[model samples]
Target: MASTPVDHSAPDTAARSKVERFRANPWLALTAVSFGLLMVQLDGSVVAIANPAIGRDLGASTAELQWVTNSYLIALAASMILGGKLGDRFGRRLYYLVGIGGFVVTSVAIGLVGSIEGVIGFRALQGLAGGILMPNTLGILRAVFPPKRFALAVGIWGMVSAVSTSLGPIIGGLLVEHVDWESVFYLNVPIGLVALVFSAVVLAESKNSGGRQRFDLLGVVLLAAGLVALVFGIVKGETWGWASAGTLGSLALGLALLVVFGLYETRQEHPLLPMRLFRNRSLTTGAVMTLLNFFVMLGGIFFIMLYLQNVRGYTPVEAGVSTLPMSIASLFASPLGSQLTSRLGARVTIPLGLLLSGAGMFGMLSWSVDSSYATMWPPFVAIGLGVGIVLPATAATIIGNAPVRDGGVASGLQSTMLQIGGALGTSVLITVIAGKVGSSLFGELTGAGVPAGVARGLEKAEDAVTMGIAPVSGDMPAQLRAAVVEGSGQAFVNGLHAAVTVTGVLCVLGAAAAAVFVKGRAEEARDMRAQAEAAGEPVGVVAAH
Candidate 1:
């Protein structure tokens, strides 16, 4: 019957089939998603390396430079849930595309603007875009991959993140030294373009179709405001004095807003964050552990960069090269963690990861101005291995525990916790370093044999000292200059030692908590199925369309 209607569109038909095949391929979707994820993760690590250059170019103080990183993280942490909710409500593919596009544009703006204030503003914008993109990437994977394969996809996703993070310092160091820091920002353009193209062609749109159409806008506002206030208070406290009324008031307000947000979320029929998800003990513990894990990773990396380049007088490339062990370790550790988690359970894997990380942090206690390469590489490898192991396992636990309908939200929540932990890590650790440096600078300078007058004069540049930069003048006598450098290095190392100690203890405590609280695979799977069944969600494996 259709023989008469055989039109001459064979080539078009073949092209359309090819397009559909590409669109349906899960791996292509992953590849497209990875580009964007790589861009964001790479930017984060690279910028840490570029901070010294940014400060010199823009005349930024230590606090101001901290703002550059803090602003992006805070913005990301605040908006992540909202971004996830929006993707679930709208379409994941659409928002993902928009997010990547916005991120690229904002990155360009950051480079063109050429001012610290402008950089801070654009970095926050870039973060907002990242928040929108990040959770949806996971959501898309959940939608496209069968339930059985989701864990493997997540492992691959974590691997991409590890790789990008590992590459960032080296790429950024090269750009900053050989070219200019702007190149790091500009690097996003090409990767983002590729992502946009592939994602447009390959990703099939998906969303949470089971939910009511209504949104919880108030929850978004409350959460955003609360996170901003908390991060602001922490970042400013370093400069404003923790006892200052501004700091005290900001902290109080933030805590109060977050409390209100929690109470308000429980009342909503369509909450931004479903309070019920926390009912799973494994999920709750995983979220907290994820936070603590990143707190150590991001915070430790930030200071480690400073220590390598500033205190130890390594060039940017040398510093980046030095960190290769950590990056390489993570690259292998991620897949290994996933495999171990599958066999031994998260309860065993996560704490084991944390122990290694904690041990790595403790290793930093031995660091000094004259610390050899031999001294640094071991801790770098340990922390990298630890972070890599925890990342995918915690992600799997958190996302796997949720009802499939809440995939986007769960993904967003996971990313939110990651960013929040990172934000807190960077701000809190820097505060520890700054405060320690401020208090000890005078003694260190004097002890190094600088005259009392010279030492007192140098105290005015405490901001510089905190960054591991000796504020030595060109006109200073050679012997005096050497003393200042020695004193400054000692003071910075003192701060570094203090900061790492705090993080190391926290990591050990987190390991203990994970061991005590996290459920094994079988228990988590049973509870997850039970929860989904009770909620009337399909309790069995769901396949991609």
Candidate 2:
């Protein structure tokens, strides 16, 4: 839900009471908030370690292992819009605790299961819980934190979540190495339990009925199914063969469903996502920019993580640490977004952020087998700074521009776009990398001076080098495997360049869109205060679209 300033004494008193309760046992509240977030973050990483083990244990083919991750992400992207709406319609606190509780239970079940099918089923459940928690985590911060400190509170929460997710792969690798993959799932139990208890004690229950309580079930289903179809089409396209009927049908059907969703939403009395929100220039631009922006960042990270571990010959820990520079840069750099808006205005901020991001991606195209980590900082720094600037500036514009009556829908739209965008980005990158690996192996074999007759045996060797198969392929000879590694690593570097090139193109387009859509700051803030006054609500909270 979008944060709105309240003029009501009762609600303000209630907010103060919660704050006072927090001060009395700040650790408890902090623990509750952070742990709830931790479970959400942990799930993002835990599966990386389990991919191989799950494949082996379940007698699954390579396709099944990818499904294990895809199912969760698909559900998350699909359900998040509804999850945010549910929180607004019912209560954010209720959903927060329930979501975490559901997540913990499903995670334990996933770990205890011995079957691949069962694990996929439970992972879907976990994603449902995640969809709930993901949106509400911000809603909780908005409802609990006072107006003056809202930005700082949300910033800290965002920082912690980012750090935890970055650490997930490293932690998962350690647990699988030392104990078992199940330990990663088990790790969430304590954290989940603590969040549940402390949240019950310290966090006050809150909701925004906004004069509507009915669930938009039809709209929800249409949007969700559309996303799943679209994501499946992209994520599984390479593995399934992009030209295959299954892949094309999925994409076509997804497109059709989204069209239906738009048509139906326009007719509904209380649409899950109001079609009218798109009428606002800032809301439309902000949401689109976020979609395109995260598509680059999330996709880049997916490829980069794989490159670091699979191609660059780094351990999980090393990969995690290598990314720390971007993480740090993001924190120190986000407010530049606000500053850009304050000085040159949103028109300038949006385009500037996109240009910065695009330039960063273009710079990353130079990666090679001989690339150094020390040289990696500049591209990462640019991307990080670009993101930091994009999120808040777009957010200020989007929410600042949207109507109060549609705040829930507006918030849901932005978040849903983010989830769907991230899924698409990650899936697209995976698809691109996998496709290139097969071709790269054949090309490498051609270059290696190997005879065509020898490819039957040598192909496995040459292809292993090209396909990034060595991290898990332990039985190969050192010389042969090293050659395979050399070939595969180079292919991945090329994949990075392609992915980065795409990012740069999309970001530049997004920048142009932002320049047209967002409002000037003085006008935006004044509009927000005026809307608050008209609504008989508090001042200084929301800006008008």
Which has the greatest lDDT?
1
Model 1, 395-425: lDDT tens digits are 8888878877677788898998888787778
- Give me the runs in candidate 2 sitting further than 4 Å from their true place: 1-34, 144-149, 209-213, 334-349, 403-408, 434-443, 448-467, 470-484, 530-536, 539-545
Residue 247 lDDT in candidate 2: 92
Clashing pairs in 1: none
For model 2, residues 466-520, the per-residue Cα lDDT tens digits are 3344432578666655665555566666656666777788888888767766766
By TM-score, the best candidate is: 1
Which lDDT values do the candidates have, in the order given? Answer: 0.86, 0.70
Which residue pairs overlap in candidate 2's backbone? 7-538, 400-543, 400-544, 400-545, 401-544, 401-545, 465-484
TM-score, cand. 2: 0.84
